[model samples]
Target: MFSFNDLLTINGISPQDVAVALHKPANTSERQALCTMIDEDFAAFNAYQSTHARIPEATLKARGIMASFVMTSDGRMTFVGLFANAGSQPFAQAGPHVYALFVRMTRKMTGPDEVNGRSGLEALQNRLLFDLSRLDTMSDLSGRLIVQDPGARNYMRVADCTPLPVVELTKEAQMTPPVPNWDALVLTAPDLRKLPNSWRVQLSAWRGVYLIVDRCDGARYVGAAYGSENLFGRWSQHVAREIGITKELSQCDPAEFQFSILELLSPAATADEVIGAERKWMRRIGTLEFGLNT
Candidate 1:
């Protein structure tokens, strides 16, 4: 029964004079743009909102908007901040009639690195992304405030100046769970890419042998990490490959693959030692003759 503008009123905002902007990016490139912004690229995110295709004042005035509430897709339409429409100007040589909308924001949630959600992976800050447990109250501005999904895609609209009703508040808080034990992880390609930074840091610090199993037919791939990024770097690159892993798995579907750690090795482990462990796993798992390692 609690609402968004109600939270605004508590913050001294007169909802009637405000417009609420919902940013739920659906395309891959747009999603990635937003992801980077929330994680470590605040300046870029700021510039992104500050510059935009201009919306005529006549159009804005027709709607009685004098201020703005911009929310990004973090699992739900979680409010990131409020801005004043300082007006617009041309952006580079980009052709006519085009303009940029500059805004000054007061952030309400914690920083992206302090968060552990899918947003860093392009599905997350468009990803307040996780646990807006404080929705009905405004005592703590550090936690994100959730607005009920408006159910429409009109990115900008007049605010009701009251509570925008929510169906369920906690459903959208999906995120990485406590980093988990290494052996307990069984990640999909999408899962790997969307993991939070803390987990990636841990993976980056270790040298290890890992496994990729094709879910489609139980075909396996055995790989080792001893170079720069260690397990994190190697695995990230593996997931990032568009066509396939090595030339051997080219004809297979990458989406059907699941990733996991087979054995953890010391960071000081030599490349030969790592590969030696890899060979052992290959023999144990029968991955060389029947799996995807070439």
Candidate 2:
């Protein structure tokens, strides 16, 4: 029944001072609300998370968010980083409730710029940022995270959080858990644009028969991916076009399409093998007779 707050205390950080930034970018709107840090550079991603917060400065300073327990929400949460918070300034260039910059504290909240405005501490402050590797040493709380659902608030006080136990922990959390394998893969039209790198890599090397169903009316399109383009590239064509490939789907919004794998093939699968599978799926699914396939 050990909790994340317990982990914080063991590291010598009081539960009272730290506010965990629970990043739960489960959908398109959610991802946009949070800075899209996953696509950012290595060190820069943590820097982005450090400076970013949707909570107002008053609440941040009032509750004393000296560090952020960076975790992403996508079903099983993954711990990303533990960043020491210094102080935060309003995001003048952006909308309200978002901070533009956060002055960061060192690992133990001891540093010069920890006061909000100071010089020459960026490199030193960045060193204070710790990733999952540091957390893994505490207790083997990595494989398959099992904590109580961290509710809707994106940020919470560690003091208020101590009562909640980290139900179970076994392995380090991936930036994203390995997305469902191809058999379980289902992609929203919006996901294609912001596809997780893990998913992009899987699709990049896969050649397969795929299906696109209109989210609005359930009209399905069976297609195939082969040659140099692969499934990733082929799926892109659906969204990249203003008008879809078929006469039926062209009348419907492309964003209304849902993409999924119909049948997977090896990278060594032949063009004939791919197209033949595509035909098999189309016939079995009745795409040619009643669906959007052309």
Candidate 3:
């Protein structure tokens, strides 16, 4: 029979503080009215629970995570919530858990009206779906339960499963004669800043070394690196050093460039083995190829 006001009191939060944090109108009179509405809503929920007694324990547990509410410019209000599991604790501690919930509530509260034109109810449903989706994505739970649903096959058919577009590389100048039966190495670095945010590093790394090249526009020669913490920096340095090498070898020269990391294998792995794995993974999840001019 615990109400939201009671929960807030237990958590040491006040309705006025919630309104101010949520950026609700600073008008004291309006703030008091909203708090009264919230109290009434909680009282009704408590009455409903007394009659039905059907609320799930998980739902009650989730309520504890919502710390505040925010009113959007369009009059929609959102409830902010948070969840903490072991893996996320480190990142969460870096910021205020309550503030994060406020941001979430602000985003959800401002959306369009739903069925019956009830903003609060619709926002709550959307928040629930958002939380459920996060749990589903992170959990190791298989789709077996979903598959058992009556319309499972129909649902699967409606789901889109398309391949990502591939970036094509042209062989302009073969400065270094291709090694006979050499394995192509693919490496990936998710954090490369210069490359298009969408562009992932895909190259082969073998024997503690890897080659990177320009996949887009093909205007630069590529370089290789070994045992570097900032592969992007090392690759850039290689490009600068090799700018002259490419110009000297191929008079019709484009600038040499460093490759980003998309796929990298430690020195312990064989080049051929890494290339094979790279090809398999790329086939499944599309990757860009880097030119290894250096």
Candidate 4:
């Protein structure tokens, strides 16, 4: 049958000094591209060997050669990184560690299927998280290469040279200004639960006028938030109920709804001021006359 040896032959590498054959499959295109990038960028390092070597004594040396292969989640092989540097540490034990690399997939890799499954928090927790601690669940790096280091080994080369995507947390994002135009913040119904705590906190801090446009039709709804609950709190209420308070939104599929903040009000703004802004927006947008703000 096909084996690692066959894989090596296909790639034109002699399989003699190989320490281990590692195969990890990345199901998404984003991941597939990363595999290619890591291999190309680190080719020289991957080719270096220990002192008992024939090649030039290079600055970077690989402890052992490893063949990294990536495939789709369904097992369709896509990319491979031959002889990638095995990081010093093999498995992570605890977290709050910064991931050197990461990618934002179109959907969570660890959750249940949308069609026949409940979209619950627990299901979301099942996906591969950036801050990983468990080794058994290494499936999160499903299509990436991993080595057990059969023996405790160290290479003279650079450590942790894997190309990892930089991650900017929600708190870090808050340090930057919000969208210059407040209305630029848009969300789909499914996006609400995924909001980071920092983002939610910032949203809840603002009492604002917002719009929900039904993309299915060109109809829109203008609304306001001025109560003890701010924009975030109001959105949380919308997340709970399918229809919300608007008949048009309730009748339309959640996928057809796009939510945006039209205006931000000061925390000290009175209820009258918030509603007045909402009404003015509704009048300007003609939502009350032809849209969904009854």
lDDT of 2 by residue, 1-294 (tens): 777777767877677766555555455433421223433333334544444333433334554343333344345444444444554433333332212223322211222212444342333332222221122333334324455556765454445554446765655544444567888888776667655566677888989999888888887889899966699888887777667865766887777778889788989989999999999998999999998776
Displacement of residue 181 (Cα, Å) in model 3 is: 15
Q: Candidate 2: global Cα-lDDT?
A: 0.57
lDDT of 4 at 147: 25
The model with the greatest TM-score is 2
Q: Model 2 Cα displacement at 151 (Å)?
A: 2.9
lDDT of each: 0.56, 0.57, 0.29, 0.46
Per-residue lDDT of model 4, residues 1-294, tens digit only:
334344445555455534332223233433332233333333211211111122212322233344333332233332233343333321132122212111112122221123232222232332322111112222223233222222222222222332222121122211112332456677755555445444566787889899887777767888898876698788766656556555656776655567789889899999999999999999999987798776
- Of the candidates numbered 1 and 3, which has the greater lDDT value? 1
Candidate 3 wrongly placed segments (more than 4 Å): 1-95, 98-209, 228-294
TM-score: model 4 vs. ground truth: 0.45
Return whichever of 1 and 2 wins on TM-score: 2
Ordering by lDDT:
2, 1, 4, 3
Using alpha carbons, what is the TM-score of model 2? Answer: 0.71
The superposed Cα distance between candidate 2 and the true structure at residue 89, in angstroms, equals 2.5
Q: Of the candidates numbered 1 and 3, which has the greater TM-score value?
A: 1
Q: How high a TM-score does candidate 3 get?
A: 0.22
How many clashes does the backbone of model 3 have? 15
Expressed as tens digits, the lDDT of each residue in 137-225 for candidate 1 is 33233124456766665565677633456433443332223456878767776555555576678888978899988888988999899
